[model samples]
Target: MESTSLQPASAPAGKFLSRFLIITVTICILISPGYIFFSERGGIGFIEGVTVKQLLHLIFPFFGLYAFTLVWGQIIIGTCKPLIKKIFPGIGRFHRLEGIFAFIFALIHPVLLIGSLGAVTYLKYEFVGPNKKIFVLLGVTALLLLIVTVTTALLMRLPWLQKRWKKLHYANYAVFILVFIHSWNLGTDIQGSPLQYLWMFFAVSAGLGTLYRIWRAIVKRRTAMSAQSATASEPTNSLNPPNS
Candidate 1:
C-alpha cells in the first residue's frame, strides 16, 4: 500500500489579513452581548438627542484594534522558545510587525476618539477624555507601556541592542496590567451597567487566573522534582549508613 503523503502548506500573501479578519470577527462575536446590552439601555446609548454616543460608538472599533494587538502580542511572545535559539532567528521581524500593529492602534485610537468626546472635553483633557480621567491615565500608561514594548521590539531589530532588548521587553507584564485596567474599567461604560462591570471584572480576572494557573503548575512541578531528588538521595544515605 502507498503511504499517505502529507500536504505541504505554503504561506499566502493574504494570510495575515485573513487571520486578522477571523480574529476580529471572533472578538466582535464574543463581545456582542456587551454591545447589545449597551445599546438598549446600558451604556451611553440610551441618552436621547445625544450625538456623542453615536460618535463614540464609531470610535469603538479602535478598541477592538488595540485589543487585537494585545492578544496577539501575548501569543507571539509567550509561545516561542527562549530567544537564544538559532532555529527561529528572525525574532526582530516578528517584533517589528507587532510594533507596527501596536503603533497603528496607538495612532488610530486617539484620532478616531478625539471627536467623540466633543469640543470642550477633548480640548481640556486630551487624547482619552475628562470624565474618564482614571481611564485616561490607564490609557496613557498603556501607551507608555507600548512605547517601551515597541522600543524593545524595534531594538530587537538591531544586533547592537539585542542583548538588552529581552530584558526591556519584560516590561510587557506591567503594560498588560495597564491595558487591562484601561479596557475593563474605562469611563462610564462600567459605571452605567452592573452586568457590564461584572463582565469586565471577569475578563480581567481571567488574565490573572491564567497567570495563577501557570504559577501553580510550575510550583507543583518543582515540588515533585524536589521530592524525587530527596527520595533518590535517601537510598545513598541508607547504603552509606553514616554514624550520627
Candidate 2:
C-alpha cells in the first residue's frame, strides 16, 4: 500500500537545478538592500558628511522594501501551489521562517523611521489637518494587523485555537492592501525611482494571486456541491424490489 503521510515528500531526481535557482534568488534578495543603499548614496562616496542618524533614516526604506517582498512572496506561494510545488518542493519547510523574517523586517522599518522622526512625531495622526499624515496612519494600521495575524498564527499550536486562527490570519490580505497604498503615497525610495516599477510589479502580482485564490475556491465549492447533489439523487439499494 502507498503511504499516506502528510509530510512533504522529498524532491524527485533532476530537481537540483530548481533548488539551485531558488537558493540563488534568495541570496540575491538578501543582499539587494546593501546594493541599493550604496547605489543611492552616490556609489559608495556618501560616507563623507553622513551622520549616524542619516544612515538609519536611509536604511528604513530598504527594510520596508524587503518586508514587502517577503509578504508578496507569501501571497504567491499561497496562491500558486502547483508552481511552488514544481519549482521548490521543500519550500513548505521555510514558510514560517519567511513570515517571521518578514515581520522582523517590517517591525524594524518603522522603528528606524521613529528613530529619525522621534516617537512623538511618528505616532501623530491627523486626518483633516494641514499636517495630515494619513499615509503614516495607514502604514501603522497595516503593521498592527500584521502583529495580530502573526500572534494568532503562533498561537495556533494550541488545540483550542487551531481551527480559529485561520480566520484571523486572513487579515494579512488587508494588511497587504493597506501597506501598498501606504507605500505608494509615502515611500521615498519608490516614488520616482526604478524601484517604483518593482513595487508596482509586486502589487499587480499579489492582486492576481488573490483573484486566482478566489476563483479556485469558487470552483472547488461548486464541484463539491455538484457531487453532493448527484449523490443525493442516486437510487437507494433495497433488499426487496418495488412494484412497477
Candidate 3:
C-alpha cells in the first residue's frame, strides 16, 4: 500500500530546520531558570561577584530542568500521538531522541553539581545531612530510574524485547514526578522565580496528557469486555432443529 503521509524527503531542509527549532526551544527553556536567577544578581560583577561554584549552584537546576522537560515531552508525545497522528504523523519519532537528550542533560546536571560541591561533601550532604536528606534521596532515586528508562529505550528495537519495552517505559513518568518534587522543594532557584511558573506549566500539561491516556485505555478495555460478553451470550446455531 502506498503511503499518503507527508515524508521528510519532500522537504529535507525544512525538516532539518524544524528539528533545529525544537532543539533551540528546548535549550531556551532549560536555560531560562538559571539565566533569570543570574540576571537578578543586580550590580554585582558577573564573574567576580559570584564564584564559579556559586554560579554552578545556580545553574545546575537549569540543566536538570532541561532533562526533566525532555522526559515530560516524551510522555506527552507518547500519550497524544495516536490522537494527533493525522496532523503530525512523525511527531512520535522524536520520543527516542528526547530520551537520549534527557539522559545526556541528566548526566550533566549531577556532574556539574558534584563538581561544584566536592564528591565527599556532596555525598555526605545528600546522604546524611539533617535537613536536605529526603530531597536528595528523591533526586538520586529519580536519577537511577532515569537510567533504567534510557536503557530500555535504547534496547526497545530488539525483536525479543519489543513487546515489554512500553511497560518499562512507564518509569519515565515516575522519574518525572520525583524530579519535580526534588526541584520544587530543594531548588532555591525554582522556589520564588518565574521559573516556578514554567515548571507548573509543564507539570499541568504532562498531567493532562497522562490523564487522557489513562482514560482512553480504560474505555478501550471496557469496549473489549462488552464485545466479548455479547459474543459469548449469543445463541448458537444447531444442526438439528427442535420440532420445527
Candidate 4:
C-alpha cells in the first residue's frame, strides 16, 4: 500500500519538475536578448540613440546566440542520453521543437542584418571589412550548413531518405565548429564580457559531448562485433558438441 501510494506521488512530482524545467528554459531563451542588450549597452538609455535599422542589426547577435544555444543543447542531449533521462526527463519530446526554433532564429539573424545593411550592400558581402572577412565567412558558411541540415531533417521521414538523413545530420558538428569560430572572433558582446566565459563553457561542453558520442559509437560497434562473433561460434560449437 505504501509503495503504491508513493508511486503515484512520485509520478506527479516528476511531471511537475519536467514542466518547471521546460518553463525555465523557455523563459531564459526569450529573455536572453534583453539581457544581452542591457548588459552590453548599459541599459535602456542606449536604445534611444539607435535607429530602428541599427536596433535590428544589434539584435542579430542575440538571435545567433540563441540558435547556437539550442544547437549546443541538442548536441549535449543527443550524446548524453543518460544525463537527460536523469535530469531533464521529458525534454527529448521537445527536441524537434527546439530544432525548429533554432533554425528560425538562425535564419532571422542574417535576415535582420541584410535588412539593416540593405540588399545591395549585403549582396556585395564586403561590409564585414577585410580584417573580419574570414570570421564573417565562417558565420555565413555555418548558416548555409544549418539550412541544409535542417532541411534534410525535415525530409527524413521519407522512405528513401530515412537512412541517408542521419549522415547529413552530422553536418551539424561542422556547423557548431564554424559558428564557434565566427562568434569568438566577431561577436561584440562575447568579447571582454562575462558572456565570453559562458560561451567558452558551452564550447568545452560540446567538445566533451562529441568525445562521449565517439566513444559510445566505438563501444557499440565493438559490442556488435563481439556478439556476432559469439553467435557465429555458437553454430560451430553446436555442430561439434562439447566434451560435456
- Candidate ranking under TM-score, highest first, comes to 4, 2, 3, 1
lDDT of 2 by residue, 1-244 (tens): 2464422343433467677887797687556655765677677566567787787776788788888778877777777766678876777656667878879999999898788777776666422254437777888898999898878777888998899888887888888888888887777667777667777877888889989988998999999999998787665634348889
Which pairs of residues collide in candidate 1? none
Writing each residue's lDDT as its tens digit, candidate 3 over 103-140 gives 89888888888888879988887534488788888988
List RMSD in Å for every model shown: 9.0, 5.6, 6.1, 3.2
Question: In terms of TM-score, how similar is model 2 to the real structure?
Answer: 0.80
TM-score of each: 0.50, 0.80, 0.76, 0.84
Error of 3 at 13 (Å): 21
Clashes of each: 0, 0, 0, 0
Better of 1 and 4 by TM-score: 4
Ordering by lDDT: 4, 3, 2, 1
Candidate achieving higher lDDT, 3 or 4: 4
Candidate 2 positional error at 150, Å: 1.4
Candidate 4 global Cα RMSD: 3.2
TM-score-best of 1 and 3: 3
In model 1, how large is the Cα lDDT of residue 170?
62
